[model samples]
Target: MEDRKQALVSRLLQYALIHEVLGIPYNEIVIKRTFEGKPYLECSKVGVEFPNFNFNVSHHGDYVAIASEPLCLVGVDVVCCTEPEKEPVPEFIENFSSYFSSLEWDNIINTGTSDEILVDFYRYWCLKEAFVKAVGSGLAYGVDKVEFHHTNWTNISVKVDGEPLTEWRFWLFKLPERHWVAVARGHPRFATENYKRTICKAEFDAEEYHKGLNLPNVAFVTRIIEQLIPVSHGEERPTMQDICSDCLHLSSREA
Candidate 1:
């Protein structure tokens, strides 16, 4: 499982760079761990300059999720939603009550159906996990410290230490039929108007990964790059040509 998770992260990192999301080469990218055990990318290990990028990875059951943003903190988590038939719903909630906030506990107990309770349990679990991972504090920053309130499936508000936090944007969606995934990104003014989601499944094979690199979806890559680049005051936004030229120059220098 660990090996598979690492492979998934590596592939996503390569995709981010190859598509000009970070303007760095695959070989130059080095994975480093923070004091809290979160993985991040650096290029200094290979004498290349580090680019502005933040990414997080999580895996469960048979799925792995990766999230990246050019200049903002990003975290992603995937949880297997397959419920075991043997465990009673109440017993399951009781076993995991320590991880839930008081409000979450109330919701789970008040939910009308066992299935609803299970769904709510995983939804809150993924949101909290994604938030902590975004802060790069991992579980050391207690999950109980943060609580999520949803006005709708897509609209959410958060509270940390019981104070409302308005700087984060969250996305929650199901991955095919087997897993639930959540992504969190933080900015003082976060908006979901530009947010997009893509889902794909690939096996962790080095040879296949290398082959896949030669076939990036240009339109999709360009769209993501445009969304990730930050706008500056009184300056024109970058064109796709400008971004591609910069990446080409970097690649030539590396060559």
Candidate 2:
């Protein structure tokens, strides 16, 4: 399992190669940890080189995920559903209630469907997590301080203990049995006009991963990457298939 996890991390780094090839310096690369233990990559140089090129990555259990854009401040998380914790709701609310508005909680509790409630509950959790993750504070930032736009779920307005972050967007989606994913970017704009180019750019090519896996399993990794990326991106964001397909095509030509 350790070997597999390490291999997964290596495979995951290949996605970063796109940045490197674009003349983003490796020595200048910066990765930092938050007070609550979230990891953030610092691309001060990359940000300058391609102001529109924003990216973030998260991995959990069997999945590895990444998000990149021509320009945007972004954060992403991948959480596996195959290992749902057995924690109770009241306890969860008790610990995190300060984060939810009364209306939000009311909407959650009053909603009749169990799945809807569960999904909503997770929606808040993952969104908050993504926000803190975006700013590099992780869970140390109070969930209550970060408020989300109710209508679109993309806009975020933060009231942290010290200061406020002006505007940002939060997005959350499910990735089948493997995980739930979340993203935060420094834009309130969720319109698809800018997204068409981003989806075209952010992708993973599994052939690199294939070098270390069995032939049959190589196809499985490719399939999983294809299936999950689009779900995470949805209609508004670029699907993983679009990016990965481009990557594979490029690799084939070079070969």
Candidate 3:
């Protein structure tokens, strides 16, 4: 279990290769907590000297994801559709409903399909989580300070601190095995950004995962890898590692 955390940290560092390109060293990466309880990294070695980069991470059962950007705050979360301990939905809704426009809740409650309803509900939850994370206050901001306008299944607009968020965007994608991921970013534009999203299966030879947290025997890690890796939907398959070796060989010739 401890090794799993190490592996995740290693993988996250690998995914943040952009920082290395910024000339930041691993030892120079400074992760600190804000007064609002959000965690941020100081990439001074990479030239982002002014505390401009922020990130958030979350895991469901086994899967985990992180988001980061230059000169902008970013928050990311992934939630497995597996129902959590049921509580009063209205209680939560009432607590933060004021932040939501009347039409928002109306549309939320009137979602035509169950899957759509569930997706929207989680979207709202993740968006709020990401917003609070972006604000560096976690739940201290009282979910009321942030609101989301779900224009459709894919598009969403956010309002924070009573200001319309035009410099931000949220992306929601469905992962295989009923998992969903969301990212909230304060960048001016994402469509033109150099973004790399990859979901690869890091094979474990001796079941390095699922040993801790006393989870069920049901296949959770496999499901998580499926959710993170970008592959044909509904196609459960494995690739030979020799394919990577072959690519490395071919690349050396070009170099």
Candidate 4:
């Protein structure tokens, strides 16, 4: 019952946000999931033609987040910090060192506190997950192949196999309740290839994607459950959005 409720609410959030963004009726909105479970909006039928208009959702601990882009493929991830009780922090994190690059691993261990170390580990993990998800790959991605470089989790960049991927963008936030959230945006070619194998492929142009200079920044907006609930009688309400229109909008509430 709990799982079903969670699933139902997730659908409600997805549909509500899609409706808000596309300004179209729910009947006309078509969201098809990849075999890997990444939900994408089918904008062609509605005459909305953004080459890589896509979104991704993630939930952890006490929050659910959705990140969308009109030109770039977007992915988001949230993780609650948890410290291991039995194993030493270094030993516990070392076991998963293969998932991170040497530089990333070094930074993760160089932290001063055990708590900081754990947070650092989760931060990188979340970033990697967001990047892969944006690229249309699931968590079972070549995570170690790409490394993130950041300053206090902002002004971030990434390198794949020691070469900078200049087109990619990333943002991170320390959410309420000690959770870390990461958002990633990148080219649609890498995103559409893996997910569209079993579905209707999205039409994306590299030039148009790169030409899309105005990407949205990440926003952690607080919303009530009532807002996510659909209104009856076909009534309508004013749309509430963040200032950075094209970025990720994350709504977090107590579970």
**The candidate that achieves the highest lDDT relative to the unseen native structure:** 4
Task: Please list the C-alpha lDDT of all candidates, in the order they appear.
Answer: 0.57, 0.47, 0.48, 0.70
lDDT of 4 by residue, 53-116 (tens): 5677777776777777766667888888877778988899888899999999999999779889
Better of 1 and 3 by TM-score: 1
**Cα-lDDT of candidate 1:** 0.57
Following a full C-alpha superposition, what root-mean-square deviation does model 3 have from the true structure? 16.4
Q: lDDT per residue, candidate 1, 3-46, as tens digits?
A: 43334333443345433555444334445555555555544331
TM-scores, all models, native as reference: 0.65, 0.53, 0.57, 0.81
Error of 3 at 163 (Å): 4.8
Better of 2 and 3 by TM-score: 3
| Model 2 worst lDDT window (10 residues) | 211-220
Error of 2 at 107 (Å): 2.4
- How far residue 254's Cα lies from its native spot in candidate 2, in Å, is 34
Worst 10 residues of 1 by lDDT: 193-202
Segments in model 4 whose C-alpha atoms lie over 4 Å from true places:
1-5, 196-207, 211-213, 233-255
Each candidate structure's count of clashing pairs: 0, 5, 2, 2
User: Whole-model lDDT for model 2 versus the true structure?
Assistant: 0.47
At residue 195, candidate 1 shows an lDDT of: 21
User: lDDT per residue, candidate 3, 74-158, as tens digits?
Assistant: 5666666654356444443455566555656777667866556555677677777766555455555666657787666566887
**Which candidate, 2 or 3, has the higher lDDT?**
3
By TM-score, highest first, what's the ranking?
Answer: 4, 1, 3, 2
Q: Model 1, residue 24: what's the lDDT? A: 47
Off by over 4 Å in 1: 1-20, 44-52, 187-255
